[model samples]
Target: MNTGKAHKSGLRVVASHSSLWGRFLQGDRHAFAEIYEAHIDDLFHYGMHFCQEKERVKDCLQDLFQDLWSSRAHLSPNVLHIRYYLLSSLRRRLLRALRKDRRYQHRESWEAFEFEYTLPQENQLIINETIAEQKRLLHKALSSLTRRQREAIYLRFFQNLRYDEVAEIMSMQVDSVYNTISKAIGLLKKQLPLPLLLLLLGK
Candidate 1:
C-alpha cells in the first residue's frame, strides 16, 4: 500500500505540534485541552502496557495532565512532539509509582509489555492448520523477547515512533533502540513470514 500520504500527514502533525505546544506553553487553556484530547488515549494505552493496574494508570494520567497544565509556564517551549513528551513523562511517573509499591521491590524482572492478539471470527474460520501453527510459533518467538525488547518494539511499531523518540521515551540511546527492534524483528522472522511480520507491526 502507498504510505506517502500517511508519512506526509505525520509531518503535518509534527509541524502542528510545534504551533500547538507554543500556545500551550503560553498558558492557552484551549490549546492545553486540545493537547489532552489528542493524546489522552495514546498515553493511557502506553501507561497500561507499562503497568497493568487500570486505576494506577488512570491516576498517573490525571496527575500528568494536571501537572502539565499547572506547570505550563515552566515547560519547555521546544516540545515538537507532544505525544513523545507525554509518553516520557507518564513512563517516569509509572516507574516511580512502581518503585514505591512493596510488591514490585523484590521482583527479579519487570513484566514485558503486553498486547492482545485476536483473529476476527470470520478469519478464524478460514485460517487453516498451517496458519495456526505459524501463529503459535510467532507467539513463542515474541514471548522469548526480553522486557526491554518488547517495550522497544511496542514504542517503535505500535506507537509509530521514530527511533530517537523511542530512545528518549525509554531513556536509552538511539542505537540501542535500533538494535533492540532489529533483534526483535530477527526473532519474529525466524517464526513468521517476513512480510506478515512487518505488516502486523505496521511497517
Candidate 2:
C-alpha cells in the first residue's frame, strides 16, 4: 500500500493514535507541540546519557527536531512509534558531534565523573528528590561501564532496539553487538550489590 493509505489504515486502529499521528503527518503545530511535550524528557535523558554535555545535548535535540520536521513530508503515517526513530537519529547526531568536537574526546571512563555521595532531599517538584540517592548510585554504576558497554546497554534497555538495529547504528557486526550487551549486563550484575540488583530486576 502507499504510505498515506497505510498510515490511514494504521490510524483506524485507535482514535488517539490516529489524531496524534495524523496531526504530525500533516504538519500541525498543536500536534507537534503535544508530541514534544510527551517526549522531551525521555529524549533529554537519553541524550544526556550519551553526550555527557548539557549544551551539546540541547543543541543536538534542536537539530534533531528541525531535521525531523524538514523530512516529515516523506514520513510514513503508519510508523507506529516516532520516539524510537527520533532516538536512533539522535544517536547518529551525537556520534557526529563527538567526531567533530575535540573537547568531547576525553577517553576517561564515565565512572571517573561519578558522584561520591548521595543526597537526602525529596522536596523538589521538577526532580524526583526521593529517587535522587538511588539515581546517583545507578548513574555511577552506568558511568563505570566502557563507552561501548554503555551504548549497548542504552540501546538494548533504554531505547529498546534489537541487536541488529543497534549493530547497524553502531557500525559494528551483529556478533559484536550481542557480545557487548552480554558483557555490559554481566559487569553490571557483578558490580551492583545483590539487593540493588534485585531491586533493579524487581526480584
Candidate 3:
C-alpha cells in the first residue's frame, strides 16, 4: 500500500469511482456490481474489526449490497472516493446490526467497536533489518493505544480519509480528529524507534 504511490493512485480511484457512482445512479446495474466487487474485501475486513464472526460479516455485506442495489436510484449522485464512503457505510450498518443482536445487547462499550489494524507481514517488510525490527515493535505498540487512537490513525492515514470525513465517520469534531491523530502519532513515535515509521506505514 505504498503511500506515495497510493496518494497518486487515490486520485485516479476518485475519478473512476465517482464515474461509476454516476452510472449506478443512472440505473446501471453493472456499475453497481462493479462497486460491490471493488469494495467488498475492504468493507468486509473493516467490518470484522467490530465483530469477528465471519458469517455475520458476510451476511451484513450481502444485505448491504442488496439494499444498495435495490435503492440505487435514490442514492447520492456523486461519491468522491467509493472506498471511503463504503467503509463508513459498512461501519454504520455493521454496528446497527450488532446492536440488534441479542448476544451483544448488554455489551455496549465503545471498546467493543474498536478499530483493529495489523502490521504488514514479514514478506511486506522493508529491506533493512533494523527497520524491520522496528516494524515489529510498532505492531506491538499498536495494542497499547486506546481504541479511538487506533481508529483515528487508520481512518486518517490508512484509509486516506480527509480530516472532516474521518470526524464525521467517528462522530467527532474536526479539531478533535486533528488532535487525536496528532496525539496518536506522537504516541507511535515514542513507541516506535527512529526511521521505522515509513516501514510500518506500508510505504
Candidate 4:
C-alpha cells in the first residue's frame, strides 16, 4: 500500500466524526484500522518528544491503543479528533510510566531529550549540502537554548500546539509557558538574521 496516501485519505475520512463514528460503531473494523494507521506515526513522534526512550515510548503507545481498543464502545469520536485524543492520552501514560520508573524520572530533565527527524539518508544529505550554512546557524542557535525553552519552541512551532496545551504537556503554568517561549524567541533573534528570525516568528 501507498502508506502516505492512505494516511492522508484516512484523515480526510475522519474529518466528519459523526459519519465515521457511525460507521465505526456499526462494526466497521477497517474504519478503526484506518484511524490507527493515520495517527500511529504522530503518536509515536509526540511520545518520543517527551519520553525520549524508545522502549518507553513504544510501551506508552501500545498501552494507549490497547486502552482505546478496550474502551472503544465508550469513546465519543464526535467530541474529539482521535489524533489529539491519543496524544493527550499518551502524554498522561508517559507521565505515569516516568513515575513508576526511577531511571526515567531522573532522565526527565528536558535537556536530556533530543528531537530528531528521520528523513531518507540521501535526501538528508542533499538538503544538508543545499542549506549547509543556514542549517549550521540554526543548529547553533537551537543548541544554545535550555531544554524548557527548546520544548516550548518545538511544541509551539513544530507541533503547532497552543500555549495552553504546551503548558499542560510541560507541566508549567500558562503564564510561565508564555515566558519561556518569549525568552526563547528573544535568544534566537540575537543569533539569527532579521529575515530568518522573522520567518521563524511567522511560523
lDDT of 2: 0.69
Clash pairs, candidate 2, are none
Model 3 stretches with alpha carbons more than 4 Å out: 1-17, 105-136, 193-203
Model 4's alpha-carbon lDDT is 0.67
Decide which is better by lDDT, 1 or 2: 1
Decoy 2 TM-score against native: 0.64
- Sort the candidates on TM-score, descending order: 1, 3, 4, 2
Residue 24 of model 1 has an lDDT of: 81
Higher-ranked by TM-score: 1 or 4? 1
Error of 3 at 34 (Å): 1.3
Instruction: Tally clashing residue pairs in candidate 3.
Output: 0
- Poorest 10 consecutive residues by lDDT, candidate 2: 1-10
Candidate 2: tens digits of C-alpha lDDT, residues 3-121? 22222233222323567878887999888888888888888887887767889889999998887778889988876556767777888898798889887576554642233434334
Between prediction 1 and prediction 4, the one with superior lDDT is 1
Candidate 1: stretches off by over 4 Å? 1-17, 106-111, 120-125, 129-131, 193-203
Clashes of each: 0, 0, 0, 0
Tens digits of per-residue lDDT, candidate 4, 1-203, equal 22222222232233463555556656578876777798898778777767677898898888887787777788775744455566678888988888997775555454443544233455555456545566567777767778778767666666666566677777899778777777776776788876555444443
Instruction: Judge candidate 1 against the unseen true structure and give its global Cα lDDT, from 0 to 1.
Output: 0.76
Residue 38 local lDDT, model 2: 82
Off by over 4 Å in 2: 1-19, 106-144, 190-203
